[model samples]
Target chain A: MSEWALEVEQLAKKFPGVQALRGVDLTIPRGVTVGLLGPNGSGKSTLMRILAGVQRPSAGEVRVLGRRPGRETKERVAYVPEVEHLYPWMDVDEALRFTAAVFLDFNPDRAEEMLALAGLDREARIGDLSKGYRARLKLVLAMARDAELVLLDEPLSGIDLISREKVLDGFLRGHRPGETTVVITTHLVREVEPLLDRVAFLKEGRVVLDGEAEALRAKRGCSIEDLYREVFA
Target chain B: MTWDFDRNRPIYLQIGEEICRRIVRGDLPPGARTPSVRELAAELRVNPNTVQRAYQELERNGVLFARRGQGSFVREDPALVGRLRQQIAAAAARRYWTEVAALGMSPEEARRLIAGVIHDDKSSLR
Candidate 1:
């Protein structure tokens, strides 16, 4: 098996009017929490979708957990998209049950624990829950799965400050270090700065900077947020 | 315990320094079991690898010792803690001196000012 949990070589994706990704090459090792950061239209979402096995790459090769993004890889990879996917009619309990039914790796007991930690009501309807609660539920669903790789795209976006902390705490609580490889793509650099083991800065459909988080900070003599601003500015 | 991490420096170094301070302050007494890397990472909301780096650094410095599968612990040697405390104090003094020197103050003048401040502060006596 490859040492990397996710690997992309000369990956390219083209839309009708825009090139979403252009010859982007990246590798994320197993058991590391990597922050895939970039501005809008920087291909973060496109890369995430490809890794999740939802969208095929227009060109180049993509491997997740040493295999091509397909049924087997999808089963081992848990993806929480930027958009809400939960059925609005389903309550928190129903959503958990649905997720458990869909993925054999889903841990219902762990989901219950995460729900309590997030202060989410199992009986609350998905439609009635606040945007933050909905986000937390999504995180809980993704985290409860014992997937080898977890991908979260803009998980903190649109979340309130208080709920954001709760959700972040829930994430830390659910994740098992040295066991799962986590890739989080978000614009909130400052908030998630500390949690990143490695970081890859994407720009205009290409990777601009990729290195260990602490090494980058030490070399640049600045925080990740400052580095992001300098790179994207 | 809460740590204020500055963005300008490496986090692993900061984590190592924080644990050093805890050792000096007796917060982590000699022979005390240190929190696992996972636990510390969760508490600080940082990457476990970062914590592992810090712990490895500390271990290299002889400030911590790991007993395979049992977990890491503060060095049982009191002399090790004493030496670590002295090293930290010396580094702090050097930093203070550098800042004072940058202000064009002589060593004598800096000493006098420090003495005056300490004398005026009743809490320093404790």
Candidate 2:
């Protein structure tokens, strides 16, 4: 098996009017949580989309779990979009039951645990749920699946502080070291700084800096949030 | 289970220091089992790997030990915890001493300042 959960090299993506990525290279070892951080327009989501196989890179190579991203790799990878994608008509329990039925790797027990941890009501209708609860519910959906590589795109975006805490707290409880590799992309650096084992600073569709989170803090003599400010300053 | 961190320093180091502080404060008595990494990480909202690193460091420094298939525990020896307490105290004292020295305070003045603070009330120690 490849040591890296993800590897991207000379990767570039373009949409007729704009370039989303420009020759980016990144590699993350398995069993670590990575913060793919940058400003909103820095291509963080685009990169995530490509890795998730929802979109293809316009230029270079992409690998998930040492193989090209496809049906094979998709089995071991779980991708959560930045926005809420759950159906509003379905209640929390219905959504989870549907997911359990659709995805082979989904675990109902794990879903139950995440539901409690996220403080989500199983019978609450998706339309009646709070924004934060909806966000947490989406995460629970993704996390319930026992994927080797989990891709979370802006998990903290547009949520209140208390709800964000619940989302992060839920994620922390379910994440076991040496079992899954989590890649989280966010422009809000401070809130997720502590959960990062590694971080890559994306700017202008390229990685300007990347390193071990604690080592960067020690070397820069500042927090990752400050470092982000300086990089994009 | 609350956590406080300094943004300027490495969190794992701060975690290790915090654990030491807990031991000295008697909040985590010697021979007590430390919270499992997942539980602590969940409570702290930090990466499990970072928590693991802190536990490994504590084990390396003799403040903790782990049993296979079981969680880590604080060292059973009371003397070990006592020495650890002294080390922490010494570090804080050295920092205060250095700051006072920079301000041109003499040894006599420093001694008198400490004596007066304690003499004023026992609660001042807290």
Candidate 3:
């Protein structure tokens, strides 16, 4: 088994007109919570998609759990996209059932616990649920799986403070350090700063800064949010 | 207990100082089991790694001891506890003196003000 949960070497992605990732290289060790931080158009979501095996990188290599990203890697890696992907007609319970049916490692009891933690109603229809509740439901679905690597893309985006707290609490509840590695991407640095063990700052499809979160804070004498502003500004 | 972390310093150091304060204040009595890193992290809403760093620092300082398969506990030495209390007091005094000096107060005047505050019945320590 490899020491790293994720490894991306000279990874690049090209769209029809834009080069999303430009030879980006990153390595995340197992059992650490890493914040994948960057502004929009910085290729955070594209890197996540590539790691999740939903999209292929145009050049270079990507690995999850020491294996190249494939069906096997997908089994151990759970990816929560930035947009809502659940069927709108289905209720929360149906969504939970669908997730359980898809992921063999999905724990129904744990899912229920997470739903309660997030204050989500199991019987509420997905379409009728508010944005916050929908976000919570999505988190519940992603975290219910006992995957080795969990990638969360913009989990707190567009949610109110109270809802964000609920989702964060749920995420923490489901997290098992030294057993599972979590990679969360978000532009809201201050709120998630306390939760990150490491951070990788991206800019224009390239890694600008990456290091242990507390070490960076100690060296810079500032919060990660301030560091982000300085790096991007 | 609630932790208010300052953004100016690293959080693990703050966590370590907070735990030390609790120990010196007797809130976490000698021989009492310290909360596990995960429990404290969840309560503080901080990363578990940060909490682990704090625990490791405390252990290195002889404030806490860990047993195999069991959780950490406060050191049972009363002498060590007394020394820890004195250390905390000295740190607090140094910080107070520095701030008073920064305010341009002379040593004698700062002493008089501290004495007055200590003896004043109108003020609450809290």
Candidate 4:
């Protein structure tokens, strides 16, 4: 196994009229949590989809868990897409069962733990659950897996305050140190700032700044929130 | 139970100082087991790695010690805690003075405020 969980060099992605990613290079060490931070349309989703092996990069080299992003890499990567697509008709328990049936890496014990942490009820249907609970459930599904790389795309976009707290709480509890590498994409920098070991500020399809979170704070003499503002806004 | 933080400083450093504050104040007595990084991180709503880094720093400073498989514990040395207490106080005093100065208080007014606090003027302290 390689120490690097993800390696990308000159990665590029073009979506018809829009060039979503433009020669972005990024490297993530195994077992580390990184924040891919930027406003919407900065190519955060494009890069994440490529890493998850759902979308291919047009140019440059990319690897997930030291392997090219493809079927094998997809097995190792747990992707919580920005727009989640779990069966809306299924109840919470059924959803967990479906996940277990699909992914060999799904851990029932971890699923139970995350369900309790997120305060989700097993009897409630996915459609009946509020947007916040649904968001939490999506995270639970991914975190329950023993995947080497977890990609969370905008998990905190439109949730209310208390719900957001529970979601953040789940993030704190669910991560397995030295086992899972998480890459979270969000514009809500301050909320996730403390959770990140590393952060890369993306802007207009390029990496504007990236480094160790704490080291960046010490060097820049400001929080990542402040830097995010200075970088993109 | 998230701890309050100053956004300008490093989070790990702030966390380390909070633990130090607890130790120096006897809230965490000598040899008392500190909360595991996972536990504290969850309580504080920060990353486990940040809490881990804080613990590592305290261990490096001899304020905390690791016991192989067990978690970190406050050192059993009275002098170590005493030194940290002083360090924390000095840092707080520096911060207090800087804040007062930033409020455009002259040295004489600042001295008067300090005197009022020393003389137990609770209202003035506020």
* Clash number by candidate, in order: 0, 0, 0, 0
Q: Write the per-residue lDDT of candidate 2 for residues A62-91, one digit (tens) a residue.
A: 999999888888878889999778899999
- Candidate 3 residue lDDT tens string, A116-226: 888888899999999998999888998999999999999999989889988888888888877889999999998899999999998999888999999999999999999
Residue pairs in candidate 4 whose N, alpha carbon or C atoms collide under 3 angstroms: none
Docking class of 1: medium
Candidate 2: deviation at residue A23, Å?
0.7
By DockQ, the better pick of 2 and 3 is 2
The candidate with the higher DockQ, 1 or 2, is 2
| C-alpha positional error of residue B57 in candidate 1 after TM-score superposition, expressed in Å | 1.5
Q: In what order do the candidates fall by DockQ, top score first? A: 2, 4, 3, 1
For A89-189, candidate 1 gives per-residue lDDT tens digits of 99999999998998999987889889999999989999999999999999999999999999999999988998888878888888988889999999999
Which parts of model 1 are misplaced by more than 4 Å? B123-126
Q: Give the winner by lDDT.
A: 1
Residue A102 error, candidate 3, Å: 0.6
- Clash list (residue pairs), candidate 1: none
TM-score of chain A of each: 0.98, 0.97, 0.98, 0.98
Instruction: Write the number of the candidate with greater DockQ, choosing between 3 and 4.
Output: 4
RMSD of each: 1.6, 1.9, 1.9, 1.8
Residue-by-residue lDDT tens digits, candidate 3, B1-126: 446799768999899888878887888999999888888888898988888888888899888898877988989988876887788899889999999999999999999998998878556654
lDDT of each: 0.91, 0.90, 0.90, 0.90
Question: How far in Å is the alpha carbon of A90 misplaced in model 2?
Answer: 1.3
Q: What local lDDT does model 2 show for residue A131?
A: 88
What is the C-alpha lDDT profile of model 4 across A20-138, one tens digit per residue? 99999889899989999999889999999899888988899997898998988887789999896898999999999998988999988988999998999999999999999999999
